[model samples]
Target: MLFKQRTEELNMKLNALAQSFIGFSFIAALTACSSSGFERTNLNQANQRYHAILLQQEPVTLNSSIPEGAVTGASFGLFTEIDGDSEDMISGMLAGALVGSVISAVTDGSNQATRYRFYNQKKGEFSVVSKQKFDKNVQCVEVHHTNKIKLYAVDSEFCRLTREDNSVKAIYGGKLQRIGTNAWHPATVIVKDELIIAVNPTSQEIPAGAQLIDGRGTWLIPGLVDGHVHLSQSGSAFTRPDMIGATHIHSYGDDQSWLIDQLPSLLEDYVSLGITTIADLGGPTKSLHVRNQLNCESHCPSIISAGELISATPVPALNGAQGPTFLNTETSAEAIAAVKMQRQFGAKISKFVFTSEAGLSPSQLDKLFSPAINEAKSLGQIIAVHAQDLDYAKAAIRAGADILVHGVMTAPVDDEFIELAKTLNVTYMPTLTAYEHYLDIFKRQLTFSEFERQFGDHYIIDSFAQLNENLSATDQMFQLFTRYVPFVDSSEKERSSLTPQEQSIVAQLETLFSERILQIQVANLFTVANAGVRLGFGTDAGNPATLHAYSVAEEINAWQHAGLDNLKILHALTEGNAIAYQIEKKQGSIAPGKSATFNLLTQDPLQNTNTLLAPALVIANGNIIDLQENK
Candidate 1:
């Protein structure tokens, strides 16, 4: 159960709370400004819904200036019949129907003499409507409730009120894994709504009526942040036609529709895996629409997104009719316009696909990054570039990119590049398994973990088991669609009739990238890490066989094999993510003034890292839903 709290702590005269939509399971509660000792005294059968609490015999606050309760007000006044001109607070409080439902409902069905201690009143008093007036200045909603919530009278004094204390209980006795410092200390955390009120030592006294959630024997850590993902693809066999043109089998349109329709569930999958934030690097314009529609929702991860990429290599999927969902190469004014359009549609980062071009002079670099990077900076956005090879990555780094979306796998990242990365403060996201994922699917060697089988999208997971049977195509054809050097310059029509020379180059480029690539990627990852360049943990999920939530675990195993210590890996997932994604502050830390979003692991992560995948409880946006079903 989540405790809903009043926003203000100052003396507020009164506030009211109407019943919120029944979707969220919460009980109505009346709490004091500071002290908490209230306990549920009433309960009905189904779901243990508590209606009222007994506070008379509980520990009361020494101060009498604080109000005992408050009412909820809203932007909509339709229920109040208030004037349309300005937001009418009086309309909500006039009926007494506006507030006090949590403390006591009107037995008469509409109006009743409810008891409440208003604005430092000595005791609760029975009252009825004595006067009615309109006041636009009074900030009386729980949202707006504060010293500014002016004293109003629909009845005599000591009736309606807003209180703050004990609204949410202190989370006691968790070994708080302090981010930035590898120290775990016993701490008590208290939250009010979404903001953390305090992070006191375990020895500190909790407020009297404050409810307590036992967190002993658990490690409390900030929620994980996956810095790379894609919402356009669903990690299904049918999700990406551009990579493998199985249009005869892959219903590209229906798959896109399913992605939009099942977005809520997809987001929940991220949450279940303890990822509270994701950065969607690039996709079609519809990605912006998804970000616009679902941003800041309680259950969904906070998203950092960009529109279609400014591609150095023209995407073969750029045709509009094939549900064009990947990169698009636009230049000069058109490129700047595309960046502007992304910002307008909630794109916080500008993405570029900077593939290495043969014999391109140094002066030609501007054509790849161009005014897009400059324009993105002008609009306060950072640059994220997809550069796989060392030369291309260096070009991107020199172009002032803030993030490298993938580890350089074509060759080892050298010391000069490492130093350059450190100087630029560029974050490196080693999507260690994305290419391997495509190979797995193509070779019919794709497999899911038990955890993935339990929690991931079954349609996608099951499709992997039956990929070849569904496609009725050879591995070579699938490989041809997933481009190489020669394929990048040609159209699908040309691909159908490739010259023998071009085909030879494709085979050569494929071997160069495929064989020993993991070793190269891992060597680059740790070199950057050892040099103190920021490291971000990102599984390029939504790629074939790279299941979104499940891939995180897979990537973690890869990191372990790469010899990244547990502490470094944890930091990469959290604080390193903060640096890479350009978050304002430490969104990946557990401390005061931080977002009250974290996960509870059954054991200390430093000792038992497997626990990270199985969060015992997930508090996202300050509320815990049923994440157990995923496990």
Candidate 2:
């Protein structure tokens, strides 16, 4: 009887909602119909007037130049009636539609014609400007807004937009040098759109009325590529605290909204460091969205991503529910589905997790890797396995994984392991700096440079500083430690004043996996590089103590410390990484018919890798970025 009464009341509420929705729909439809008719007439009239004026005046050709100090404005306008114009009308139409939707509906809908109104200095009044407006005396410009966009009409090419360059640019009179080799020669690199058209460009004239940049005494090399990074992971100090097994103070995971908002600035930071491409090893679906977003922009590194992680059941590294980036699969079908999902999300690499502690067993590993590898191969995605221990490394290599994302930290790489890697043609991505970062965190020696302090996450820096001052604080780092290791203490004051037994345990812990582990890892890296096993460069920069932009150089220095050749390091940073990532045809080299992604250096990086520490200018996809302001 009670259920019947509740159902009746719910039905009545739903019926009321339905009636309201029907009335709203009717009003919307009627209003749209009335406004469309009025909008179409006005749009037609605007188009006719705009075209008639253009037809009367002989189209004047204007130079693309701006006065020293001029105020520029961009609103919305439609094209004139002249047909066959190839300018983009989408910007104008979208701007007009946005304005119309907000302000009024009486504006035109038929003719999407837009125009620019220029403030002519000599005339002392605003004059209508067309594609042919040739007045050089104009100091200011404004765009006129209308309802209809003249989709087929010619847009005014004479309007001077602020910070907008719509032509192929050139940098000649510079010594172009190929990376990893000591070959420097006088050559001109021609760029069209985002690709390099020619090297030692034989063209008699620049195409698209190119802008010239004087590269008189500079050396050019392919832009750097970091093989492993995580875009979604905040490499800031505060964010890394959660990784240390600490009490929750900082948020562990960022929502999609936060990821999207911070992506632009993060990409710029990578580009500012002369990085043109980076492979994201693992992250949530939000990472994929951010990757696609950056691929569309002019000033960002080309992002290749894993999209999601395939891990053992329980996901020892991170929880899927809390961190939505990893897919823990206990069955072969589940593993295949995870790989398929990653492929669907446009992942160029498939990342599998192999941890020694509570990770997949041998049989479970077989079930997971066999199907995951098959799916990844079918999708043409490179397989990267994160294996931190020797056993896991052997298992990944045996499973035909294309890349080992990290070196074996607990043990040295022996002859057998090197031979197996060589036989399988597997690339070794030695994240040497990552281990060093762990040591830095354990020792409380983490410090930031001025640049990091200026641009890094302030919350992270402050929190880490607090941790350094008071290791016993129940902060994010403390939470991380306690969550992972139950034996660890959560009490701030008690942890600070450790008992004698606890102090002894801590001392033993320090020796167990501290500096000695890093030394062994570096030794393994040296052995692999020397034995001719393919060595790839990666810093694991998104981890704690490893920063994104700055860590590229740090990784190089670590390689240098490991006694790797400078030329080999450069190759790994560029051409080698491109081959590993399968983007050699499009990027990784500054050859003709490649991407115009290279760094303009004041000194030759072949002489000293440190030369890349400060690049004069960084070019990516034909866009020359001035790093002086950012520096």
Candidate 3:
């Protein structure tokens, strides 16, 4: 186990060194051909948020022409002397014309391009590869098109540059609605590079050559964030063998291979679904490898990951899962060592598994979690625990757990717990859909919404829809998993096309509300919300049936049913989660000097929660995402 920890730390170092080299080479290449220019453009673009100017432009050479070459050659061949060897002159002209034709044949092209150096007020200077030539001594508008920036010439007499700036994007005429606020107003948001320079400017404050985005009748808000997810799983029926024992149909090793290969696309899928950021609660060491890949990607969601789950007990349930699962630490010394290893591997949070099946005993909870919690605190890392059971959660909180990664279930929230949570400043994320999705996966019924069918990886979901294909495996899973939530009955079985043994798992399976623990989970959510507990939204994506991106709307429905208003839900999904995780400085809200990672919706998110799934525009780290392209 220590060897695995050492290997992960080594991997992080090698990854960083390699990435630095890659970054340097990329900047070098851009220097020769793209934005890294030879000299400063240094126009009136400094000390302002959204104004810039073009530094210089180099036009690509025009194509050589045979007719023009012939004319030039004829002129050279013609003699000024009168009546002297007209035939000689004709012969000379023919010979020169033939040579010119050969020369023109050697060099010809039509794809003319221009390399323009642009200086922004805040982001400094960069070069652009454009098809059209941008004029000098004038302001330009920068637009992202087809994964590249496009420049348009904008001229205005009313605008003047107080500081040197060449380019700016004034997204004009949109009703902006910020998270946690019901207020809306028509405003022009001026953006330079990736940050908002000005939300609304006076008429005289309009910068020269600012590109305008038609935000008319649109709702622009902060991009959504999924507070809890696991990149190690594939969000399919076979992703977890410890939970379902589906190894008979699909081995865990092969399933993980598919997921690792598909992880990059999954990152883009998150942004395409209007989620620009994600917090990976627990995964294997290779989750760091995925984060490395994410760092190199152009269009993807930002990730904050805990490299592996530091278990308080030896986990038999995770035996066949992806990567090494030998992270169980029992002693206080072992617990502190595990925290150090995760921190060395670049994990921002120290996450521990504290469930009943494979968690420390109630009496041993403080002894095991305390040392790790203390080490994490000393190392400036957050402590998150997977303690859904009420008593287990209380134990972790008392042990200085900063985040309860799941809702406190198995009991209702009382004044004692709420007061404790408030006093500890504990953040809670109620991953409402993962339980139901798991039930559906094991019970042999998955209701794929039209949105899920359209946006989700259909191949993965379709694998579960093969009726009678793996009924025995499904039954095996159902038998093993139903002990925790066994509300399925024969009445629902009579309506299905499946055999009696299968329990009709595919005919609009109803919510298992009769389950007492589930009732407690729902009741505890609204109780915490009204009690003013720090609440965040997460779907426990990568768990069985809780597909990434496609699962947000479903969880939104659950939040609504739990009596959380749409505004609160939106805030929880965005700024609330960021604030909980202490990452509001980098993301979570749309504000001046912050990263321009937000979404434009076709409908009001407050009025209709489902509309969050479909955004008209999504910007992640300043790169505009095309939703249809992902589809």
Candidate 4:
């Protein structure tokens, strides 16, 4: 008789709770704190009980500290309150729905008689106010329930409440911290949503309910950025076998088909190497389509591109490729139209290829150069000029080019050129590693440093290993350009006259290789960088053996070997590159209002730049990428 009376009482209370929800409106639950006050307490015993009930285990014993009034039964108790904002109530509702769903699934209505009470205080008395199932709210908040376990909660199924993540995430206990302005301190990088909200010193307490990433003894630094790259081509000889020696100098064939197919793998390769952003200097007009196709806040690195490269008619290197294949223009009007068209195609920057064997006439140069510079400037866009030689570089500078995509590789850079570049505020991309690609391929051997071995893409390394094993310098197909052949001497008369043995001997001569030229270029780069000239981080990745992910580390190590300070090298890789790319406003730093993109290193990169070769964790736009999983 007593059990029947209790059952009737429980049904009456539940009915009242359900009725309280009707016509009250969700607006009434907008902010639970809107009520007069709250006496928040953390009840460990209540949390224990809640988990036990959800796990379908026997209810845990409650501590005496739990108020007798709050514990109606062994399975029912109030948990210790964790501090939260207005979203806490929503979190509570989501969590309640989570528990209720599990209970409903396991019990199959046998436990339907069980009563779960929710309370809110008014007039100093806790009362059963309402009960409602969690559902999508009209205010852009959706609760997605998944049966799979999550990183945050491994033992329990996750019910992800997708609202703007307003809670702070604290990365604490780092022995070393690197933030914007090159400040290194023992600080926690606090992130909320997509932005880095703060970098508080270790002295501060981690915010309640904030997501915690235990840095422990690791080093925290801003994610690295590769200032220049080309997504249109894969960084392999298979994609561009002609790179070995462009003897034919015909169109680069149809890369669009393969480019569209391999875009995901290319982007993943870069992001896995801790590269947060890549500036695609030049590509086909359809480059914009590729950019649009993959652009998103996901695992991929951010891609900014110059949709197409504008070049003068009769570009010596391209042979006779024209139209969208090479965006050729001979008049100022055509140049303007080309720039505008590229912009229309969603180009973030303007790229002009200034290539000439004898240099263009003054008037001809002005017609091709002036309009592109003027149009890009008027549109507030920076121009990346591909200048292969000092003369062409000078022409680009005169045209007010903002960035020189390559150093003066044909000859040594002089003080006059350096001063001119500095005065014009031109950023130089030495692309030192780009030369090594040709050197390594010609030598019929591929090598990597210990750091590269660890961090480099296994796919690229394995591919090179296979190439090295299958091919040798004696192969007839490789002999076309292996005999120290000069690229510009269109007449192959010199190579044709050489006997087979003589050609083999010429190919064996190490001095015949242009690797020495690259060394001189690196010396010039060091001089220019030390002289206060701006140098951006670019390895001309996508060039033959300058493999995307591996080359970034190799490039940094190259600079380090050239005696650049680690901090300055880091600055160039991060902020300086961002500035050169004109994206510093949104990226390049661990500062408030900047994207929460950074790398957690197992070791301090400041001590050894190669420590960045493989990041322990790469956080891009608030998403943590598992480097190992991707590898």
- The C-alpha RMSD in Å for every predicted model, in order, reads 22.6, 26.8, 24.3, 17.3
Task: Report lDDT per candidate.
Answer: 0.66, 0.65, 0.71, 0.63
User: For residues 333-424, what per-residue lDDT tens digits would candidate 4 score against the true structure?
Assistant: 88788788888878878888877633575345755678778988998778888876677777788888888876777677878888888898
Task: Give the TM-score of each candidate.
Answer: 0.68, 0.66, 0.68, 0.65
TM-score of 1: 0.68
| Local accuracy of candidate 1 as per-residue lDDT tens digits, 480-585 | 5343544533466866687777777666666544546767888888788888888989998988788877789889888888888899999998878987776636
Ranking by lDDT: 3, 1, 2, 4
lDDT, residue 146, model 4: 34
Q: What is the lDDT of residue 32 in candidate 3?
A: 71
Between candidates 2 and 4, the one scoring higher on lDDT is: 2
Q: What is candidate 1's local distance difference test score?
A: 0.66
**Which candidate's lDDT is highest?**
3
Where does model 3 exceed 4 Å of error?
1-167, 201-204, 294-298, 316-322, 358-360, 466-468, 473-514
Residue range 201-260, candidate 3, lDDT tens digits: 322234545554446567887889998888888887677766666677777788788887
